[model samples]
Target: MADDDDEGGFGGLYEDGHWIWDDISKSLVFVSDLPPKPVEAIQILAKAPTGTVEFRDDVDLIEQIRFRRRYQRKLKPGQEDVITVQDVKDIALYTAPVQIMSPLLINMLHLPTTERFIRALILYSAYYLQIADEMANRIMELEKKIRTPDCDILEHEFRDNLADLRLLVAKEYSVMLIGGSDMRKFHHMGPAKKRRSLSDKDARLFETLLRMCVQIVWLALGRKSFNQIELETNRIFKSEIFNAVEHTLKTGYINNMAKEERVVLLGHCLRYDKKLNTRSPLMNEVFCHRPIDYRMMGLGVIKVQQMSPRLHYMLQAVAGPEEKLSELGVVVGILGMPRSAFDTMLRPLPTAVEKSKASMSSTSGHSSSKSTASMGKSTTAAHKVYPDVVLPRKETRELFYPPSFPDEPEKIRPCSETQRRRWQNRLMKLLHPHR
Candidate 1:
């Protein structure tokens, strides 16, 4: 809202590639849409003994991108460093689509309306998860039930249900968010990531989902349940998933190369667990089935344990008198919480489980982060909704990264006049939908 002459202004927005930007106040500029949190442009500049951010307004085109960058200081006092950016000219002045969708507003890709949207998504997600949980359990039960009797008649009955279950499984999509990819070359590699074509919005979310798919598939493989359900994940990563990921990644910016890291690490997860190259003090590695990252959901069975002490009783009560207590172990295991509390209280009933497992659509499927902990959060929630929403993901090739600005640019805030017009065009569609 401030003027270009004012610290952090919009003058550059109105100008073409040829515009000067000097509206930087010493205060940290905050743009909710920008990733890894609002970068302290002044702080990054303060690190420079002779750092500066000035826009060059002498371009051949009208959309003279207003650019910004600086030399930086080291952790040690009085030490200065120049982080060399080879395409500094292009990068420093590029305002990108990733930048445009970085804000929470653009997150409304599927959430056309607000207040009801989140609750609706939560309800939708809860129901979806409930079904997934049921499907997983049914898959377990059916496998156990059918395997006990290897008669031809039982096999035929199982096959019929198997076809139906597969169709059910394919009805919905599950999302996963990988934090980063190993930018470093995987020479000691076997199969590479697959190059499944994805839009920028999808690029960010699907890649993570792809990584998770690899892990989940591996988990299923580990459990040795090869033929448990109906239509498998269409987007499920095969050996080609990694190839697709690596193939696309090699085409992106070096800084953005970490996407490959996530997929590669996932490949490693398929073969190894969390102990991919590094080992824990306990010599323990976390497996995909028991992802340490599952804590993000905040409302899963894991969190339920924190709320009560009688969950174990509930789970036990769910089993029929003929069923052993061990059968319901998965209900507790997938949650990774103290089962004695709530699950113990609301014993999972077979009929209830069967009802929840009934097939429902699942569209399961974000950007960068500063700290590793928050990275997935910024870029992931969209993937949380998965194949349903149409959002942008990082593409394999980005012809233009958004030009750098004095500070992080806000969502819908254009760095060049041309971009403003482009956004305007999009706004027009939203304002006047063709019904």
Candidate 2:
């Protein structure tokens, strides 16, 4: 509180480093030796603006120059982080879910294999469109900095092209797996042996196209991880089918076209199933056996359920059982025999085999002594390529349902009561055939 003096409305009220000079309202002024800390400055460039100059101190000038240089460096060719290895490792994105309709699509969905390919083609197109749209959007944003109007026309064109592509692919695929002599072959073949009927060249070509589509989809969508795809490719390459193909190719036994057309179809199926869907069917969990006479195996030579009917019959004649006997009646039963006939045929074989087992075991012991000698001698080649089944494990790791991902510990899919009972019945039939 202050009382007014003779000549003063209010004399300057001096405190620590400031003086209050105003009377109606208090205002303080201060002076200090320490200079204020420099704050970082940001400046936005104008769109299509005439060149303008700004005045700034040494620090601000240096900061602006450095920012400009960094921006310029980013615009340089081959400097994009998106295409770099380190960025790929860090980002690790891939294409999303796709249902790889089995090659047996005709049997399973009553849809042609070409229809499934078209679906996959649509997925690939989706990926391509997404990438194009993203790039277009980025360009639009960048162009906005240079020119204010939006790229509405470009956006519209992209959308139209995408729609047209989908429609065109769908329409074209409708006729691809049907009609013509070449196409009729595909339709007439058994669902299980469709791919087998193809010349190696055709198969490989189809596989290559599928592989490319899958690869592109993954690169664009970033759904699955890179490691999963790589492992799948490696597994495919190491398969017996690949080996057989390679062996024949090297020997010139397989034509160049057939050699090129590979069985990468199953690999893709496995990839889509395991990496994308939990309910993926066990496509590769199939068994094919051939009985041979040489190894003291009680059943004489026989070939079972081969992909090629011609090859199956050929091998049967050359190496199959001399006597025409239904070994376990499995083949005949599987061929849709009458239930009563199947039951009647199934009995007594096990007892008969049991009685012969003791003699076979003693002979098998003798054969084991000569196993090393037999190992060097080549047995007739009856190769049944089950790509998903590893040789070391006779059975699949996932019995009823495929795992959605490799890391998934649970092997079984959650099923309805009916499905669970159906699986139980099948398992019982398989494991305890006598029952």
Which candidate leads the pack in TM-score? 1
Q: What is the C-alpha lDDT profile of model 2 across 304-407, one tens digit per residue?
A: 22123322322222223212212321121011112122111121234443443454454332211110111122111111000010001112232233243123
Each model's RMSD to truth, in Å? 27.1, 32.1
Tens digits of per-residue lDDT for model 1 on 307-416? 12222333232111112323333221112221222121112334433332341123221111111221111211211211211112212332332353123221221122
Candidate 1 lDDT score at position 182 = 21
What's model 1's TM-score? 0.20
| Candidate 1 lDDT score relative to the true structure | 0.25
Evaluate all candidate structures by whole-model CA lDDT and list the values in order: 0.25, 0.28
Q: Best candidate per lDDT, number?
A: 2
**Candidate 1 lowest-lDDT run of ten:** 365-374
Candidate 1: segments with Cα more than 4 A from true spot: 1-151, 174-200, 216-333, 336-435
The TM-scores of all predictions, comma-separated, are 0.20, 0.18
Regions more than 4 Å wrong, model 2: 1-150, 176-181, 185-435
